[model samples]
Target: MKMFGLRLLLTVFLLVLLELLVINIAGILPFIASHKANISDAPYMEFITDNLQHPIESSTHMIEEKNPLFFLGSGAVVLFTIYATFFMKGGKGKYELADKYGVHGSSRFAQRHEIFKQGETVGVPAKQLMKDLEASMLVSKGEK
Candidate 1:
């Protein structure tokens, strides 16, 4: 769980970095382009200094003027991070079951249903099966 949390944090960091890169590029591209005809001729250091001195002021107007795509990109990144962090399953047990029983499916619900069916087939009571499943999951996760 600690490892997973670390990984999640890293993933979120990378996503935010990507969003910032996109937004910054969108915000600064026009200013940079208009400053000079050639890329090499642009006042790169001065632009950086100005932005550093007034980061929000420098980017706000440009961001406001640009199309909604920049905001959409940020929103998409946030949504993706949320989905990945909270909704995604690690599925170690599912993969273990698949390898053991040859069951195949990507859906977590179907995978769990198949496990329940297998437990029933093996004469395990539903209540006991659920307990066993929970125990196994905890053990697999190193929480028990």
Candidate 2:
């Protein structure tokens, strides 16, 4: 469980770093947009720049919409996180041992029926059949 938590944290950190790297490479860094209005321009150029003051905002929106790689990476991370949380159980299944031994659900019922059949064939009570089976199992294990 501790290992799982660590893996989940590492996955989130790597995904965040990937997002930041993608945003930087796309030249849509949020700091640049937030600070664009603080940049100084020549007084004579200010008149022409007034119409362009919101260009960074518009371009950032466009980049966000058009950047397919960013969306793909984000989606992959979300899917992987969900899979890790819900499906991946560190190589163990919910019924791993039960399934391996055919000891769950219909299989368990089938095993009981098989034991009943064996008891009937041998003309013995269920308790005697069970004891005989147990003794045989112990002998087999000792032989192994």
Best by lDDT: 1
What would the per-residue lDDT of candidate 1 be over residues 71-142, giving only the tens digit for each residue?
A: 676678788877876778966775576534554463344456556675466676999999999999999999
- Candidates' TM-scores? 0.42, 0.28
Return the TM-score for candidate 1, rounded to 2 decimals.
0.42
Backbone collisions counted per model: 0, 0
| Candidate with maximal TM-score | 1
RMSD of each: 15.4, 13.9
lDDT of 1 at 46: 79
lDDT of 1: 0.68
